[model samples]
Target: MRKITLSNGDTVEVECLSCALTSGLIESDGGVVIETDYLHAHQAVAYRIE
Candidate 1:
């Protein structure tokens, strides 16, 4: 599994071998956008721990 830290300090775990479409909210310099990817592609999940 791979991890990606968002600008808002959120960490997401991505599976390289998964085949399922996932959805998550992303915060970028331009603004916030909803990110989605196919099941076959790498997926990212963002969530706050605290």
Candidate 2:
């Protein structure tokens, strides 16, 4: 897993691979299973919540 920040100053703890495959959880193969793009994630949730 890694920490990724967007231009809006929002941070997310995700696993990004090849700048395409991104996910909240790490996949079996160093790739991410993108469910929802970070562009939609709210600022409430973050790399380390509370």
Compared with the true structure, all predictions reach lDDT values of 0.39, 0.38
In candidate 1, what are the lDDT values of residues 1-50, reduced to their tens digit?
Answer: 67766545656566631221223233333332344452223223333334
The sequence of per-residue lDDT tens digits that candidate 2 reaches over residues 1-50 is 77766434555565553232333332223222333534432322223343
Estimate the TM-score for candidate 2. 0.32
Best lDDT among the predictions, by candidate number: 1
Clash number by candidate, in order: 2, 0
lDDT for model 1, on a 0 to 1 scale?
Answer: 0.39
Candidate 2: segments with Cα more than 4 A from true spot: 17-50
